[model samples]
Target: MFKLSSTVSQAPISINDSSPAAQASTRLIGFGQTCPQQGCGGASTTLKQLDTRINPDNMCSAGFNASTELCVYSTTSQTACYGDNWQRVGTCARR
Candidate 1:
């Protein structure tokens, strides 16, 4: 759990619940290290924002609930890895 400096301004993205996940586009902001494995604290400290969408799949196979959980993936190589918590930003309505 990382804490933001008091001097830094906090502008959190808003969640768009009115629209469906498939219809809405989003940019995921994550502070994750560019490493191969988990447990590596974001020491490399890479702040990335990847454009993605909700991926539809069986909950049993993907290990995520369609009703509650959201599964998104980036077409590029960058991704939100382990140790990257609270990384879900919000919908990109402006874009």
Candidate 2:
């Protein structure tokens, strides 16, 4: 986890669709993706949350437990790509 310090001032809360108490909360963020031979950076996409409890899909047999594991997928791709600090790359097909 990372922490950031902002220099801007804070504002008061106003309850509405944009409020914190709103029901339809968004899970959008600047997700990391590949940039081919150049590098992977400055890419953004929405994450698809996966629940191992409801749909295990052999994730538990692969040593990923529902209690501690948090699996997600890129909405734009059928397979998920992973890089270990750009040292090694691997791909896991979506089930």
Candidate 2 lDDT over 1-95, as tens digits, reads 75658665755433232222212222222233444332446443544321111223353356554444323333344333232111111112222
The deviation in Å at residue 78 for candidate 2 is 3.7
lDDT per residue, candidate 1, 56-80, as tens digits?
Answer: 5442244455555455665676666
Q: Residue 84 error for model 1, in Å? A: 3.3
With a 3 Å backbone cut-off (N, CA, C), the pairs that clash in candidate 2 are: none
TM-score of each: 0.55, 0.26
Q: Pick the candidate with the highest lDDT.
A: 1
lDDT of 1 at 58: 44
- Clashing pairs for model 1 are none
Global Cα lDDT for candidate 2: 0.31
